[model samples]
Target: MKTTRKILLSAGSVLVLLLTFYLVWANTGLGSETKQSLKIDATASYGDSSNKGNVVGIQAFVEPVDYASEANFRRKIRFYMEEAKKKNWLIPNKSIVVFPEYFGTWLVALQEKERIYSTPEIEEGMQTMVLRNAGRFLATFLKCPQDVQDKLKYSVFAMKAEVIARVYQDTFASLAKEYKVTIVGGSVLLPDPVVENGLLKTRGGLLYNTSVVFETDGTINPQLIKKAFPTADELGFICPVKPEAIPVFNTGAGKMGVLICADAWFSEAYQTLKSKSADFVITPSYSNGYGYWQQPWSGYSGSKTPEKAKADVGKISLGEAWVKYAMATRAKEEAGIKKGINVFLQGKLWNLGADGSTIVLSDSAHATPFVGKSALINLWL
Candidate 1:
């Protein structure tokens, strides 16, 4: 009887503690404004006759904000871009600045700052944010009527479709032109992403994980490679693109190819990209969770983990697998490319972990990793 009573008391205390924590979190305001800058590498490698000039990987954090719109993103980006400039990373007219996958996805936080930041879980924050913005969302929805399938799709996308679409387009386009530099502008989720006359557009409501490449003038086309394989965690929100092969992008820098995050994992993406005359590959990636870089690879994600892999695949550390499979084995062997560059997103958002450490892959497995709070890796083209 005494033992039963103690158990009951413990359970009750736990419940009270949870309730108190929730109440405090629910009542909190938005986080304060943060000033941030991206860390850049001093120099990558010198460009040879075959490849392009300097490829610079930028490590940055996207701060939670009440207004992460195009203008706002541009401002925040410029804050760090100034550092790159001061450090002479701009590289005159011959440089290209690269960022990581999902770098643009955090714009959703701006929609409901207090609720988004207060909750330590992204999925929960997004759900509540949807509710908090229901009225505004409904008003926005009525403007675009859809078929049954689109309606179902729109339900998933409606919360921040317009905001994401607008911000994704305007932010990078303006930056490429303003800075007069080529930018593999990271990636964003858009419903049915398309390029209409050298500009990106969205149709329907099913979302795709798409990355864009912008010339100094931000001219469209030879850009917009959609993620062919999205990890299991992404299945809830993203659709794989139908294009069998990625478009070979031609910038002043030379011909380039892109593989968004998980797509970079498979050898097929590399083989197909090389056929299009790509000299090197630019893979924009994101891996969440602290120390995931040092943790075991386990298996593929989303098909995702912390979850263990099946017996056949075996276990390895996450960082090791990335260096071996993602870069050395798949990219170098299958594609037969001389160089590959990767930039990873780094930041904290609710439950999301940003753990990709930036790397530069050469013809051999001798890759240089830039692991720091702020890191930069530069290679001469």
Candidate 2:
């Protein structure tokens, strides 16, 4: 009996030690060993390349992101810029290149374990991220009582807010300086983002989907554009900011007004731009799910669909709704805007299916939409 008890105790001790080791290993930051490379296979272009437009819209159809390291992400993004350089689409100081929405939001997964990248579902990856940083995440989660609907998402953004800002700002700023062109660095979900001394910083508050614009000299614009309309999916986590005035940035390319995706559907958005006398408008947008563009229109995503847009809700497809109601339709008619750039992000992220045709409008008429990966849609201003 004594020998048996000793044997059982030894086994239990060994088991406990094994569990401890496994927990430490699972939480430890194990960098990804997989070398990622972006292939430009489904390359397509719209508009006349010979026209040499001062404004270029990069239909950055990216693949499933691998946030193993910051450098990997930069390497992948650089491919798009390099491709533009080779085609002479980018002209230093004379060109403004716009990217699609949610371009930097994925930075939340930066420097995660290999498992995070290999997970088939994005939720699983985020779970791993939370598990790895449970203590910090829980602290953040408790701090955000105001965001009862999306406290989990709020916690994720809040816990890693600083790092997300750093990677996102630094990446775009460096790229703009390196390419010597004005870059609208898509959008990132940050808590009350503000520009101070030419750097993007976040104050602890409700998260907002914000877009940052970098000048040719790499200085961030003082005015940070926040999304006025949060989509149905975003409503739980994102807060719409009522700006005192929507800004029209004066750039070498032109007076540019940027309206985030869903905001383009509202007449008030265009009116704001019109009041500013914007020369051109760029709508950085994202459409989730596979083949959603072809799906039947579900009407305006956030808030109430303006009475004018209600009739077309069920009758038209989502793609058609964009052309008829979004920047393509509103830029010229309401804003008297000469050109409009509506760019969509393409690329499958786990179960998050991606679909949208990048549309470029000149004189309010949209060109043949480019539907494929790694495409460049340009309109000569």
Candidate 3:
């Protein structure tokens, strides 16, 4: 009888622990830490335009947040941006706002409510879901015909596709509308990104790291350009696919082109934009480690350095290397871009230590150029 009691007690304890974990997993909130986001730093050089046509790089600091719904992400952004106007931050007619790459990419995790936010570690949270959905994950990514795993994966992402895309679009579109500025919505991982009739939609197969542009009216502009080159870590999760043809956006602010994350590392991209006579470039990037910005240049990101630039990554700091090769060497000199902005997200998401501070490279002399670590950088068009 005593032995029987011991067995039951052990079973009960296990059940209790599982139940406790479940409760904690499914409902982790941002907690009591409600404070206005720190400005961190701000710099402006060679852009003292008071009248109009300003491009702003928002180096936002995101928290370990799990959204109950997609709108919550927008709410958070709105709250953080309240500090902008009071500081006399420049927002004028025909302005452009650039966010960081993959800033909206994590919204897909919200599909699994459990531990989406409550998991103490981002890797743990993503892994937990990945374990449960292993078969489907493989199936969708693999895209094998008549394969149960592939079909299941496709169905899952397809069902959640609209939500993931919507959360991304709404978050940035809303901001653009509120500020009355054309906004680059950053990059999101979607199975298929199709912008039809000014609404974003997705189809399931393999994911692509895609960035979209939104006009001031909170509607998406129909320019679907995929990342031409992806970082090593992004390989398994997404595939690199370029658009059928390069398309430059003719926004009122300026003739703008976007290079999402590592896409900016290629000269071909710059050449394509230059062919279209792109007036300004917005490069949205996310460096995985916090100190990578200060690390020595480890050769080209993916492409060969231009022979004309004669760049030696080994001899230069990573930042200088970026100014040289990443944006296609002497961006102002080669691309004919007198003004540009590079924005990076500054937050700890999952395992990614967001680094690579924002920079606004300009050929303007009288206007001070952004050189150091500044969370926000603005340029006049």
Top TM-score prediction, candidate number: 2
Among residues 3 or more apart in sequence or in different chains, the pairs in candidate 3 whose N, CA or C atoms overlap within 3 Å are: 25-115, 45-368, 45-369, 46-367, 46-368, 139-149, 139-150
Q: Model 1 — which ten-residue stretch has the worst lDDT? A: 303-312
Candidate 1, position 375, lDDT: 59
Q: Write the per-residue lDDT of candidate 2 for residues 231-280, one digit (tens) a residue.
A: 98999888887632557899887799999898888888888998888898
Going through the candidates in the order shown, the clash numbers are 19, 0, 7
Q: lDDT values of the candidates?
A: 0.67, 0.80, 0.66
Please estimate how well model 1 matches the true structure, expressed as its whole-model Cα lDDT.
0.67
Deviation of model 1 at 218, angstroms: 2.6
Q: lDDT per residue, candidate 1, 1-381, as tens digits?
A: 999999999999999998777656544554334444344434345335333466777666654552433455777677656766665666544667888887776666553545455567767876765555566556645644443234433454545766676777777777777877888878877767777876577775567777888778766554578888878777665667643657887766777788887787776687778778777778888887788777656687764322223432456667777776675457777877777787777766566667867767764554355353555666666
lDDT comparing candidate 3 with the true structure: 0.66
- Which residue ranges in model 2 land beyond 4 Å of their true spot? 1-23, 26-29, 41-53, 145-148, 370-372
Best by lDDT: 2
Q: How would you order the candidates by lDDT, starting with the best?
A: 2, 1, 3
lDDT per residue for candidate 3 within 223-247, as digits (tens), equals 8768878765665455676632556
Candidate 3 segments exceeding 4 Å error: 1-40, 43-46, 50-52, 66-71, 88-93, 111-120, 131-160, 302-311, 364-374
